[model samples]
Structures are given as structure tokens and as C-alpha cells.
Target: MSLLEQLNQDMKQAMKNKEKDKLAVIRMVKAALQNEAIKSSHAELSNEEELTVLSRELKQRKDSLLEFKNADRLDLVEKTQAEIDILVDYMPEQLSEEEVSEIVKQTILDVNATSKADMGKVMGALMPKVKGKADGSLVNKLVLQQLS
Candidate 1:
């Protein structure tokens, strides 16, 4: 099923199960996706567009999780973590660190990226292949490691 369809089904299930946290997160993400669709010229988002929205949402939660932890806000941290967990359920299967590294290495080669200066070239050619499959920070780290 498409992500939107799956989200709709899960939202119904969450409501039936009385899973408040899950339902809230699903609704929030659904709204975000819909807003992105409206922002663009099209009314329906393509798979890539949906993935982009998903990635942005996940990244926002991860950033908040870090900030919450750093501030020693245990309660907020827990809530944010639960939200993250819920969002993750809708994400694509993640690529492993080794797998991402290998792809980064190949991307470097494909772009002829020999040094840090060529990082942009490497990443430009790489993000499309790895988007929604791996963490951005992990990919950036691997690309830097490979180039320098």
C-alpha cells in the first residue's frame, strides 16, 4: 500500500485500539503530508515527495530528542521518543551503517571525489540513492571518511 493508505489504515486501527499516542502522531504526520502536497503544485505527492516529508518529520523528532536529553527533561524525552517510535513505523526499512558506507564509497568513486573539496559532488550524486534509507548524519560521516 502507499504510505498515505497505510497511514489511514493505521490511524483507524489506532483509534479502535485507543492508542492515543499512536493516533496523535499518525494524525500529525498525515496533516504534514497533506500540507506538503498542498504546498506543491500537485494535490497528490509522489513517493519521493512523501519520503521527503517523512524524513523531515523524523529528523525533527530526532533533533528534539537530543535537545530534550541534553536539557535533562526526562518526561519530554520519553514523550518525544514515543513519537519517534510511532513515526518510525511508517518509514522505509533503514540501511545499515556498513551498507551506507559501501554506497558512500561507490558514490565517491562515481563522482570522482578525491578530497573534502569534492564532498558536495559526492553527496549530490549520493543522497538520491540513500534518501529515506539511511540517516543523513551517518551518510555525511561516511562520505567525509571516504573522501578524507
Candidate 2:
């Protein structure tokens, strides 16, 4: 099933099980997806578009998680972390650090990226291959390590 279909099925199950947190997350994600679709003037989103929306949602929650942590707000931190956990369930399986590093190494070579000057070239060619699968900062770190 597509992401939307899977979300619908899980939403129904969450309701049946009285899982309020899970249900709420699912509904929120659904609304985000629908909103994105409407913005793009499409009735249905392609897989790439859905992934973009999911990533945006996940990133927002993660940023919130970081701010909450910095402000020492344990309550908000925990709440944001829980929301992040729910968002992750719908994301593609994350690429391991090792796996991402290997891909970074290969991409660097493929693009002939020899120094930090080529960071843009390497990343432009790399992000499409790893988008939604690996963390951006991790990818940037790996690429910088390889380049420098």
C-alpha cells in the first residue's frame, strides 16, 4: 500500500485500540500530506512528494526536540520525543552511519570531488541518492571527512 493507505489502516487500528497518541500523530501526518497535495494542485502525491512531506515533519519535530532539550524543558522534550517516535514509524528505514559513509565515499569518487571546494558538487550529486534515507548533517559530516 501507498503511504496514505498505510496511514489510513494504522489510523483505524489506533482508534480501535484507543491509542490516542498514535491516532493523533497519524491524523496530523495525514493532514500535512493532504495539505501538501492541495498546495501542489494534485489530488494525489507521488512517492517522492510524500517522502518530502514526511521528512519535513520529522525534521520539524527533531528541531523542536533539540530546542526543548536546550531550554531544559523535560516535559516538552519528552512530548516532542514521543511525537518524533511516531513520525519515524512512517519514514523509510534509516540508513546506518556505516552505510551512509560508504555511499558518501562512492559518491565523492563518482563526482571527482577532491577538496572542500567540491563540497557543493558532491552534495548536489549525493543528496538525491540518500534523501529521506540518511540524516543531512550526518551526510555532510561524512562528505567533509572524505573531502578534507
Candidate 3:
């Protein structure tokens, strides 16, 4: 089944099981996907567009988790993290650090990125390949580390 189809199935199961946290996260994802379809005036979103929206939602949760942690609110941190976990079930499995490093190295070569000045070139070429599998800030840091 497509990711969206799987998400829909899971949403129904969550409701049947009375899984409040899981249901909440699933509802948020459903709303986001619906919003995207409406915004683009498309009858259905492409797989790439679905992945993009999923990644953005996951990223937002990660940011909130970090903020909650920094504020020493363990309760919110745990809650936000649970939501992140639920969202991740719909994402492609993440690439390992070694795989990410290897790709970043090749991207730098392909883009002829010599310094931080060429960071944009490297990132532009890399993000498409890395999207939904790698953290953007981590990728940016690795690119800068390589360029420097």
C-alpha cells in the first residue's frame, strides 16, 4: 500500500484501540496532508510531495522536543517525543551516519564545493537525495565541516 493508505489504516486502528496519543498524531498528519492537497489544487499529492510534508511535520516535532528539553520540562519532552515516534512510522527509514557522510563527501565533489562560499551549491545538490532520511541541520554542519 502507499504511505497514505497505510496511514489511513493506522488511523482507523488507533481509533478502534482508543490510542489517544497515536490518534492525535495521526490526525495531525492527516490534516497536514489534506491541507497540502487543497493548497495545490491537486486531486492527489505525488509521493514526493507526501514525503516532503511528512518530513516537515517530523522536523517541527523535533524542534519542539528540543525546546521542551531545554526548558527542563520532561513531561512535554516525553509527550513531544511520543508524537515524533508516531510520525516517524510513516517516514522512510533513516540513513545511517556513515551512509550520510559518504553521500555528503560525494556531493561536495560533485558540486565542486571548496569553501563555505559554495555551501549552497553542495546543499542544493544534496538535500533532494537526503530529504526525509537525514536531518537538515546535521547535513549542513557536515557540509560546513567538510568545506572548512
| Top TM-score model | 1
Who is ahead in TM-score, 1 or 2?
A: 1
Alpha-carbon local distance difference test for all models: 0.93, 0.94, 0.91
Tens digits of per-residue lDDT for model 1, 22-89: 99999999999999988997979999999999999999999999999999999999999999999888
lDDT: which is higher, 1 or 2?
2
Give the clashing pairs for model 3.
Answer: none
- For model 1, the local distance difference test gives 0.93
Question: What 10-residue stretch in candidate 3 is worst by lDDT?
Answer: 1-10
lDDT winner among the candidates?
2
Clash list (residue pairs), candidate 1: none
Residue 101 displacement (Å), model 3? 0.9
Root-mean-square deviation of every model: 0.7, 0.9, 1.0
> Measured by TM-score, how close is model 1 to the native structure?
0.98
Number of clashes in every candidate structure?
Answer: 0, 0, 0
Per-residue accuracy of model 2 over 74-136 as CA lDDT, tens digit each = 999988899999999889999999999999999999998899999999999999999999999
Error of 3 at 43 (Å): 1.0
What residue runs in model 2 are displaced by over 4 Å at the alpha carbon?
Answer: none
Q: What residue pairs are clashing in model 2?
A: none
